[model samples]
Target: MARTSRAPRADAARNRDKLLAAAAKVFGERGLDAPLEEVARRAEVSIGTLYNHFPARRDLIDAIFPVRLAALEQVADAALAEADPWKGFVLFVEGLFALQARDRGLNDVLARRYPASPELSGACHRGFVHLVEIIERARGAGLREDFEAQDMAPLMWAMSQVIRETADVAPDAWRRFLAFHLDGLRAGAAGPLPAGPLTEEQARGRPGEPAGSPGR
Candidate 1:
């Protein structure tokens, strides 16, 4: 009886593993909004089985993305370790965009598409702390004094759009955009602006949200 009971548990574990693998592949290719049904089909399991393992989409996202997003922390660490602050900052920004360009689901995560996942939110928060440090260091070196950590959100959003639009037709198009922007961030290139940068809370909120909207 004990051995028979163990067999079902083993099968369930296998199904769970298959679901995770399928979800990762489907989500990576199609973004986080990819249907759970496709993940189930790719896993060769019933939709019920997928739901059995991950009751909701956020549950699956929580499982798959936190581990992947952990790499962002490592990238930040590498940036911080670099001797040149400006180079370090560039490394962090370029590394971030490159990762997003490679994975559509990750791009959505960076854009805060699913605000309900605790794991993803925590990961993003931790990454933000590192970004603050990187920006401060770069400012001390040669970055524009007016540039704030909050400014990166709009810059990243624009880059995300560029990557999405030109991925097939011009895979390296974002590089040109990034270079132009990086130059503008230089202290020598600084100039008066019509408006100030967003507050951290405003930056975290959806685009066009009122300045007072609660951040996700």
Candidate 2:
């Protein structure tokens, strides 16, 4: 009787794994908004089974994305491990955009297409902590002093569009764009700009409020 009960539990676990794998493949190919039916189809599971594993679209995304995005932390650690701060910063930035270019689902996550996913939010917050260290280290080593962590918001948003627009037609187009941006970020490239950098709130998708303040 115990063996019989364990068999059912093991089967359920297998089904859940299949659903997650299918969802990752589907979402990576087609972005986060891809239909649930495709995930179920790819998993070779009934729609009921897929729903049993993940009741809502966000639930499926929450399960898959946080794990995938954990790779970002690995990238960050690699960057920090580099001997040269400027090189580390470049590695971090290039690594990030490379991941975005490769994965449609991650591109959507970086773009904040689904803001309601608490898992993704937590992942992003952790990424930002690494970004701050990367930015400051780079600044000390010839990155523009005035460039703030918040500036990464616009840079990411811009690159997100470039990746989307050029993914099929010119998959490496973002590389050229990134080269130009990296040059502009050098200390010698600094010049007076028309506007100031974004606030921390703005960087985090909550504009018009000071950092650490109430949300309303």
Candidate 3:
């Protein structure tokens, strides 16, 4: 007879679930770099147990973010369906900013790449392509001929910072900032800027640097 695969032990399964829940909470509050021990502590488990369930930080991130990434893609798809290119572009940007404002973990995910996680990397790549399409459509509609898709990274990075700093004192502060930036992006907003946009590779975040490192 062929050997049968064994199911996870009941306690092991429960521990995994607890770890995931705690990780989502901690990562949401502190970003992906939060200490693993905190997740274990919140899950009411030992650190060793947490390691047993997820051998690496990337493993834990992979488990927690697939749904969130899928949701982001859905938002992109919705924006792409809008008939007006400028409207679509605005909707896409606002949707992305809203997502970052709502979920700290997702904010980090958008701004950074965990190189070991292929799934996350692929999802981010797709999102980048979608952004290019949105930018092209808007340009074709005479909205912002000077705009470049690569400009999105720095913009998102700045917006994330705005959200982080003003979350408590002025939760809607990013709206004011975004409005000013958007006006500058309009077709005839001003004379051409001196510096060129960053390359896509640069916008993707530099290796060994935190996502959206301004120094880059």
Candidate 4:
């Protein structure tokens, strides 16, 4: 007997898309531990349908990761186009952090594994290179201080680590933290950003911040 391939019904295609979108959100928030069955439920599909599309968890995760990267690239590219390099760098970092905060699973799982690989690291390196170019341009105009490109790489890595593992810190303090991080990189050699891998126990951010706290 010969193998027969069948085109999925139209409804099956819609269900597959819904599953991917919901799984992206669920996995982004909760990590890939989210059950496929649960994803199917959230997407209003049946488990059989999900399995039909994503046969394995890794398949789903790997697929979603690239899609997420594309979205981030678009946002960062727009931010990098700002006239002020300093402002552009700050906004780019801000957008980057927001994506991680909203999707801790991606930061914790995919990012940690990829950053250590040079080929994998290059994708992210582009973002930092773009940031450094902006900062240098700002400095040339005396709108910013002298900052090296190399500094932004580890700053980005450290900030992502801090955001991912330190869930105890209240969310509202992120902008203040970003400001603190950026301030150190400004023209004058300010002090250091606390070396991250900062556990929740380490951050002294406001506990249960008020509604109007900065960046809320």
Candidate 5:
């Protein structure tokens, strides 16, 4: 007879929950590369228990970031639903930067690729598609004629850098930089450019590259 898998025991389930919660806390403070040992310690569990639950860092990351990824999609949806495309575009950009400013883990997630995690990779691709639609709508409404869908990734990458550098010292400083970038993105602000925007594949990064590659 074939054997069926049994559900986890109550204590084991509790330990799993603790580990996930601790991981969320640790990754929020540090980046996704934060130590798994720290997460185990924070959960008051042994490293063995954490490994039992997550098996690997990618597994832990895959478990912890879905909610944040969903939140980003919701922001995109909300912005897309706005009647004014310009307002929608602005809201999308501002919302993204605000989330990154607050969550270091999310900043890392947004700024990188995770090829090994299919769920996270799919979510990122979907988010990029949403951005493409949003940008198209904004352009249709006569905003940022020079802007391309691929430009969004580079912009977010730049903002992530600014957020990383200034977040501790001036948590809100990214806002000022974003505002300046927004100004430059305005319709009438278009001027002769030095070079064309990066291609979508280029903006999304090459395979096997580091997670937080600017292309991502």
Candidate 6:
């Protein structure tokens, strides 16, 4: 027998969730231009159903991109609540890497559009701040090397870049690379190029036009 869904309102919510799930898969494969009709088909709904939930392209993109950003906050909250800061930090890295792996296009899309949505960027910044606290506590406990709070953002961004690119490879391969960075470079806070702590003017994502070009 088919499993019964909830009341009418709850069933509507389930349909919304199904559409989003289908959209995530479709968008992950094709990026922002994934066909909404295919998404509706995958969700076993009509095109009208898809529009009923998300009427515009930006709305659909918002559903896919920023939702993961919000999920980052929840992961940060969970990890920070754990007993060991170092353990928490590891969880944070793994969670972030997993997010990128789910949709390889996500990093590129976010790198460009992160600045457009204050809420998405702010959530990421908050998550990084939470990680900074963890890093400081872990260093204070002598479990990790020293890193200034400002250094955290760039370092995290760099590591995120590495992980995003290396994602979908063998899991251990990425872990080994991360371990090298953590043990040799990041663990010591020593680098040829110094990055001061985050400033009031600087934001989380790297906001710049494409190389040698105006207006992308």
Give each model a TM-score: 0.91, 0.90, 0.84, 0.64, 0.87, 0.63
Among all windows of ten consecutive residues in candidate 5, which has the lowest summed lDDT? 207-216
Model 2 ranges off by over 4 Å: 206-216
Best by lDDT: 2
lDDT for every model?
0.84, 0.85, 0.79, 0.60, 0.81, 0.62
Predicted structure 3, TM vs. truth: 0.84
Full ranking by TM-score:
1, 2, 5, 3, 4, 6
Write the residue-wise lDDT of candidate 3 on 76-119 in tens digits: 88889999988888888888888877777787777663443678
What ranges in model 3 sit over 4 Å off?
Answer: 1-8, 113-116, 140-142, 207-216
The lowest-lDDT stretch of 10 consecutive residues in candidate 4 is 207-216
Model 5 Cα lDDT, one tens digit per residue, 1-216: 123333446678999999989989998887777788899999999999998888878888888786677788888989999999999999999998888887898888888734436788787777656887888889947577879987887888889889988978998999999999988888888788899999867987723446453221
Better of 2 and 6 by lDDT: 2
User: lDDT (0-100) at residue 109 of candidate 3?
Assistant: 79
Better of 2 and 6 by TM-score: 2
Estimate, for each residue in 69-167, the C-alpha lDDT of model 4 and write its tens digit: 555676567776887766776777778787777786566432453212343344444434465456666674433343555455455566665675664
Query: What TM value does model 2 have?
Result: 0.90
Model 4: lDDT equals 0.60
Backbone clashes for every candidate come to 0, 0, 0, 1, 1, 2
Candidate 6 structure quality by residue, lDDT tens digits, 70-180: 666777787789787767776776676566556644654544433345655554565455766666766644343545555545554665566555555653456666676
Segments of candidate 6 deviating more than 4 angstroms: 1-18, 29-41, 44-55, 64-67, 103-115, 125-129, 142-146, 163-172, 185-195, 198-200, 207-216
Candidate 4, superposed: residue stretches over 4 Å from native: 1-8, 45-48, 113-129, 139-150, 166-169, 190-216
lDDT of 2 at 78: 96
Choose the strongest candidate by TM-score: 1
Which of 1 and 4 is the better model by TM-score?
Answer: 1
Report lDDT (Cα) of residue 198, candidate 1.
96
Query: How far off is residue 195 in model 2, in Å?
Result: 0.9
